[model samples]
Target: MESVVGNGCFRLVREMANIQGRDVFVADLYVTPTWLDPGNTDPLLHFPKDADQKDALIIPLWIPGHFLLSVMRPLQKEIFFLDSLYFRRADGFSSQAYRELLRGLAQQIVAGAWTEKTALDLKDVPKQTHGNDCGVFMIMYAWYFAMDACFDFGVDDMCLLRRWWCIVLLENFGLEGYGRKFAHFTDEGKATLRDNVPPVFRITRKRKLESPMVSEDLIQYPSLQPV
Candidate 1:
């Protein structure tokens, strides 16, 4: 199936425009739910690019309403539950299905891999005390997780994070760099992360988030927003 460039999470997915062809998948609830459906004739068209040649796949899932996320790293043979609220895998409907789907994805990417499947229980991940920052948190978490970048963001970093998001989107709206580079999947990643620093972008957020990413999440499903 030819992959469509769809990158989404929630309200941004009604038309189901998610990013693909880079092993990064971020689809909306209703649309991507079809991927897990047994009757789907071509589920791969949803996301998770050409798995045959890619080094890894990163799937950042958003549990609707609350929008918390679980990152599926198929190549690493593991899935990371990055819940700002510290929610458990079994705490929600979508989270529960993600584990099994990840295993399926692992098998598709590499047979018999990721067999010891388990969401690596992480305790030090930054949490959102009480705010609508879950989506923002998911975006940052996926970037740091996907790029294997340092985890320096905290509750105090939210304002900066939001502002940074704004700048990046404003500047990158017309860029064509999506699915081209993914050092984030490499053992010795060469991808440079600038989120830790101040913003130098065209400036662009608020109002359900207007992510200026090229597309795809766990593309933070850097699948941050729709095109």
Candidate 2:
């Protein structure tokens, strides 16, 4: 069988099939750049300073929604959704537990009940790269994916914040397209990224919800600050 690699939900699918990269030429669909000619130089995908090339793919899938982005807002205008704090312990963090904390804190931040320090802590993890860069991961990815799944999802205020903050974080990291900019890429750079997608990549169409539903916990209050 040809080895096929998958991102997000693709991991489960690939695992079931026992595909390996060498056999199938597996690659992540979202992060690959199509325009890099391999002959020409493009700084966009350059590895960070002092970073090992082998260690580059160590991306975390945990994004703390607006909990980190809210505090990092003023400094950078674009935040990549891939930015995340990585814990490489043999016995490591629980994804469920961390996601619960992020959700709870995001709710509090929206409610205007979160303290300034709490916001800082969420945004300012010590081992972060990019100097004070607050990495966003899965939680943020889920929110963004929801917006892509529906227009109504994009119009919601919480969704707007998520998008805006993501943009800011990316810009801060000296990359283009975080939120709105990122969406535009879906059209502009779509050809490039799509073309670059490994041939073995499988496209999965998501079922759209019939009704525009905002998470009950995402309800907006009068006191919520303009994002």
Candidate 3:
């Protein structure tokens, strides 16, 4: 579970080029632990000095068994806290403490001080119906926001979303014969997935899959292909 959350964050950063004309800066997950450490006053040290200049920053928060998303829009002087579970209290830290920490981080990044308060607010983002969907929600939150699109997805859409996410990752990493794996999807379903795809991804050009070597491997995971 922890690995899934970490991979989600990694994929977001690795596939960031899929979002056209966006310069979202994502901090390393390792810095999260340092931020959570109460004794660490210079938690931002792990972040690049110029991170504050980016249009948006995505930070993944993990507390033992849960994950959450924190976005800082420095230009707008606002920090948006998104939790799929909507828990009043997260696993390892009090909501107030976390909120204060976020606010302080935003202030330092944007205003370079703790005296100025930015518009820190918890957004009513989409929620997950199942307990295990938090990691998916975190990745989706980063993906949608980075693309400058609203997240209209919910728990029910996760299965399909997960498939699309896999396709995107595979495509980004230049895995061969990716198109062959989803040959059964109707043009409409394919179009829907394409429409939701970030503009930077060039999936319109069809690449012929000439080899059948990986066909069996793909066949075993038909559920991961779009229906």
Candidate 4:
């Protein structure tokens, strides 16, 4: 099985846009190489100059194939590392390495060597039951964080949550009828429907009234004057 999930970071970007009600700036997946790369600070510098003014920076990280999310709160000077697997190991881009890297970047961005390192918080965010669901959990984390909501769902809910995501996406793009059409189907059924439908017919149709082919004079009607 391919380790990388669909759309990678773009999925998180879309969810952020939907929940934050504003455009979210996301760095390319290539920004940070493997989490183990010592030169990971370069990606932090690549953030937009005005990134500090935004609510937070949502970063999608790839450990070779597995996925995770890193959220940086500039104003708060805090960085949160959310991993669905949460493996307890000391090596290979463990939480400590990320914390140190974030601290260095924080100091560099502030332009003050004396500036305190940003706080690093390792959250007990939701975990995935299956190996393949890390990407889904990453998306859920971004969605909940963007909306300032709690991560209340778990792995068992992922199957249904995936379908709900499609519905939300369609509704957001003004395809309510299509969203409703698939609302009652199972996720697999919805996927089959989506696969079979052509892109041109996915949108709802608008009524087009044909223009009158004959001149108004040809029509019999009561005269404007007294009949």
| Highest lDDT against the true fold, candidate | 3
Per-residue C-alpha lDDT of model 4 across residues 1-227, encoded as one tens digit per residue? 12233343355345546544654555455565543566534655668888766666666666755766666666666656777766443322335665566666666545443322211233445666575877777677766666656668888888897786655555433344444335333343356466765443655789999886898889899769875
Alpha-carbon shift of residue 17 in model 1 (angstroms): 21
Which model scores highest in TM-score?
3
Residue 72: error of model 4 in Å?
0.7
Clashing pairs in 4: none
Residues 1-227, model 1: lDDT tens digits: 00121132221221112232233444443454455546443435555455544433444454445554555555555656556666444542236565566556556656665534222355457777777776677666666555455778888788897776554443333244332122233212224342333333454544686677674432442346776
Cα shift from native, residue 21, model 4 (Å): 5.2
**Using TM-score as the measure, what is the rank order of every candidate, best first?**
3, 4, 1, 2
What C-alpha lDDT, on a 0 to 100 scale, does residue 48 get in candidate 1?
49
How much does candidate 4 score in TM-score? 0.56
Please provide, for model 3 over 1-227, each residue's C-alpha lDDT reduced to its tens digit, 9 standing for 90 to 100: 45544564465553453446667777666567566665555657756788777777777776667777777777766566767766443432224556678787787787753332211233445776575877788777777767767658888898897787676545443345444334333343365466753333446878898865766555665356665
Query: In model 4, what lDDT does residue 141 have?
Result: 72
- Model 4 backbone overlap count: 0
